[model samples]
Structures are given as structure tokens and as C-alpha cells.
Target: MHWKEYIKRMPLEVKQITGPLVLGEGPHWDDRVQALYFVSIHEKTIHKYNPASGEHTKTTLDGRPGFIVPVEGALDQFLVGLEREFVVLQWDGAEGSAVKFVRKIGEVDQDATKNRINDGKADPRGRIFGGTMGDEKSPGDFAQEQGSLYRVDGNITRVADKIGISNGLAWDLSAKAMYYIDSLEQNVRRYDYDVDTGDISNMRHIFNFPKNGLDGFPDGGTIDTDGNLWIAVFNNGVVIQVSPEGKLLRQIPIPAKQVTSCTFGGPNLDILFVTTSHYMNKPGEGDPQDGCTFMVTGLGVKGHPNVNFKF
Candidate 1:
């Protein structure tokens, strides 16, 4: 079905849950604690929101923490992708007191000064898969493609290289396919996935987003129970739902122009929690809810539980 048809069939109501963040991204919903965790990378802070009580908790980090995923079988432990390395962090106490710094697990680019880890998540087999991007320092200046995607299990291995702004990562329900996003390419690619060995192969372009049209470059995404891909279009203020065949199924409008990333959360896994950023807008200049986190309710679809990093 066309995106307009899907939007007409299922009109979604978008509501803001929090205030303006510097650059809000990386949303991870913990079903066990019934809380949603996300990050403001430019602010160096981690936020935890309890939907039932409308209670919000914020934790300060040392570096630019890009993404955070729960550790497998560990309630208080999490694997975080910091600026140049991956570290283990622990949350203590009841009210989200302080973020404890644990040991360093791995580093992304120790020698390179411009490259940093951007986005990543755990696969079905409990291994963390992530990517990096080259820093762009000036306006209209494209950063060199020095980034690469890495798989973290017992040891870190570079799986793919020559990347520009690595963003989204997701696996199909059958664990036979992997979806990845390279924002600079403005396209989504599919690869044959090996669940047992944690290997990806047979890469092919599935969707090429139009640069001049409504859809911008794809940023972050998650998969639903119906085998559909819900991807955030950066600079487009929309999250589009697409099928495995790369057909646009639904489009959700957000309040902010830089809609960074999204995930499925809430008790029933029915809530489509989204994150936005105020990258180029000043305070009170753009949309009032530009940098706030949004929750799109009544979607009638449940998302797969996020897998934890095992090693």
C-alpha cells in the first residue's frame, strides 16, 4: 500500500513527553523496569522516563555517549558507546541517583582523531553491532569516510568499512536478514545474516531515499512484529514504516525537523517512542517541541524486545 493510504488508514496522534534537549537520540525501552532510556549526546546526559508516573530521571556521562543498551541478564548494567570507546555503566539506587563508570570493554578508533562511534544495537544472538562516523567540523564540509561498522562479542572485529555516518541497525524476525543505514549514502541496505556465528553477508541496497523529496536520509530504525521497518528520516520530521520489499507503508509526522531516532517501548511494547534534536535551531526559534521526546500512541503494532549485549 502507498504511504498516504497507510496514513489515512491509521491516523496516529503524536504527543510530547519531555522538554527540549540539545540533540536527543538513542531510545532504549527496558521492559523489566518499565522505563524508557535515551541519550542527549551533545549534552552528555542519559535520561530515564517512567510513563506510568510521568517521572523523569537524568544521568550525566563523562564523554559523548552515543548509544546505550542493557546488558544481557544484568538489571543494573548497560553497554554504552561513548565517543571513542565502549564502556560498561551501572545505574544505582531507586531515583536514578548517579551513573557509575565501569571498566572499558572496547574502543572504536584509538588512533583516528575524527572518527567516533555513532549508533548501534544488539543482535538476536546477544552481540552488540555498531558503526562510527567521521566528524564534520565546518558548514557545507563533508567529512571523510573513515568510519566502519564493528561487531562486539568476545572481541571487537571490523565487519564493514569506508562508511559515512553509520546510524541504524536492525534484524528481521527470522534472524536471517540484517538492515543497516549509512546516512551519507541516503539508502538502506540488507544483508544475509548468520545468527549462529554473528556474520553478515550478501549486502544489497533495499531503499534509496530521495534527497529532494519528502524522505531524507535514513537515520535510525526498529522492526515490528509484522516484519515492517519503522525508520526515522533525518531533516524530514517523519518516521516512515516500510515493508521488507522496501515499499512505504506508513509515515508519521514529528514536530521537529531533525527526527534522529526511534524505538518501541511501553508495557505492551505498543508505544512507538521517538527522539528529536535541535541541531541547527536556537532556543525558542523553531517548533516549541523541537527537541522533545515524542510518543505516538494507538499504532496497533507491537515491537520486538531489544536484545542485550552478551559479552
Candidate 2:
């Protein structure tokens, strides 16, 4: 498809949410439930958005929730990364249903409060991999070498020590490589990912942004069915579509200052759902546009199905 045609096909209406959202990220679309699962880390909230009925429901958490994903083997289970610990949590947010403890962090800090888990996803092999951001004051602080990427499976954990601001992660099917972002460094790194062992190697930088005119940092992202990487740029309020080889294919400009994450959804995968934030910067003349949810037509990027809980 021609790139010009793609822009012409932008969706008619971008959905707006009622929010003064703080630190929004990690959007997952559940096709079976016809809902979008997203996190507002600062609010310590998980929200469910149903398009068909225009119904939105939010559930609060005790700990600042970072990334949330379903179990790969169990249909009814889910995992949540809270500030201080990882937990097997019931989707309902019940008081006694959160199974957690301050186990040694498989790869990094022991105190969750010292670091915040950012973007994460399950590999085809069913392991969850993500990293954390250290406690910092920048609206979305991406600095701190203490932030390390992690892999969690069963009782064992693996940590990659050279990481900083571990955010945005996904994989390619044929090559089985892992694509990850170091949001703080303004770079995206690729790895020779070992799915079965949850190990990564040949780690090297592939791309970095915030070039001459860009304002945002890199945030969360997704891999399209075609293996392209769609990354949200933090301060810039834009999403960039890139080829697996680290080439920029195109860009989608958004009104929000923080384009925290992006996911492809809807029946045909032509819809792109972006989660934004209301946490940073002085409101521009059009600041309200920055935090609203955006949907654009003709993305042509179909996302992989969310990993389900294995029972």
C-alpha cells in the first residue's frame, strides 16, 4: 500500500477517555472479551475498555501496577508486576486474592519501590521478559543503570545487568529474536533470544532516537504480524513504524505528549489503539488532546494474539 494512502485512511474518530491519567502504558487487547486492558501506573489502576458498549471499568491496585499479562498455559490466570514484587493476581482485584511475596528479583533490585517494572510480554515459549526504571523524579525518568531487564519462569529468574529503562518488548516468529527498548538511552536493542531457557545474547543496539527535532523518549511497543516494530516515542507524542532491520517505515503523529504504548486490534487489524499519559509537561494550548485514546484506521499491522493463561 502506498504511504500516502495510509495517511488518507486515518480513522474518523479517535476515542477520548475521561481522565487526568498519570504514567499510562502497556496496552493489551483481548479479542475474546472485546476489551482493552491497560495500565495507569501512577494511578495504580487497571482499566478495561469495551468498544461495543462504550463501557469502561477500572480496578485499583495496592501497588503501582506496571505490566499486566495473562497466563500462557492457564486460561483463567494472570500475572502482574507490582513495584516491590511480582504477583499472581486474580483479575477481580480482590483483597485476599493477590498471591505475592518479596522474593529475590530474578535479575535486579529486591525492593520493588526502588524500581518500577515497565513494558513486558510473554514469549512464544511462555516466559515473561521486561525491565524496570529506578525511582527517579523526571515525569517519566528513563535514566539509571540500576534498571535491568528480566526473564521470569517458574521459580527461577534471569537478569540482564547492562540495561536502563527497560521498556517495550516483543519478538519475531521466524527468527525468534527479541526486540527491546532502553527508553532512557533513546535506543532499541535486539537480542538472540533463547525462549526455552529465557536467556538473551548478542545484545547490541539497533536504533536510537530523540534526534535533532524529536522531543519524546521511547516508550512501549508491539510487533506486527509482518514482524515490523511499532514503537511509541515518549515525549514526542508520536509512533514510529519500523522494519525489523531497524529502518523507519513511517510515522503516525498523535496529540498526546506521552504515547506510552501501541497495540493493533479490531476484526481486521486495521485499527491501532494507543495509550497516552496525562503525567508530564505543561499543558500545551491543546494539551487535552495529548492524553486521550487514539484509534486510526488502515494501520495494516495485525498484532499477535495476547498470550493466554495456561491452566
Winning model by lDDT: 1
Per-model CA lDDT versus the true structure: 0.84, 0.71
Residues 1-311, model 1: lDDT tens digits = 85335534675689899998978888988887888888888888888888999988787888888898888778888888899798889985245477888778888776677777888899988899988988767522547677899999999999999898889988994748999998888888899999989888999988878833555679999999888999998788999998988888888899888888999988778789999988767555778788899999778687989877788
Give per-residue lDDT, candidate 1, residue 65.
81
Per-residue C-alpha lDDT of model 2 across residues 1-311, encoded as one tens digit per residue: 86446645665445565354777777777766666777788888777677677666767778787877765544334566777455666564332244433233343466444777776777777677767777776664545676777777765364676566778888886886888887777888888877667678898887767443456677888888888898998778788988877788878887787788888776555567888887776555438666667666656556777664232
Model 1 lDDT on a 0 to 1 scale: 0.84
- At residue 79, give the lDDT of candidate 1: 89
**Model 1: residues >4 Å from true position, as ranges?**
1-11, 93-96, 139-142, 282-284
TM for candidate 2 is 0.85
CA RMSD for every model? 3.5, 4.0
Candidate 1 clashes between residue pairs 3 or more apart in a chain or in different chains: none
Q: How accurate is candidate 2 locally (lDDT)?
A: 0.71
Question: Backbone clashes per model, in order?
Answer: 0, 17
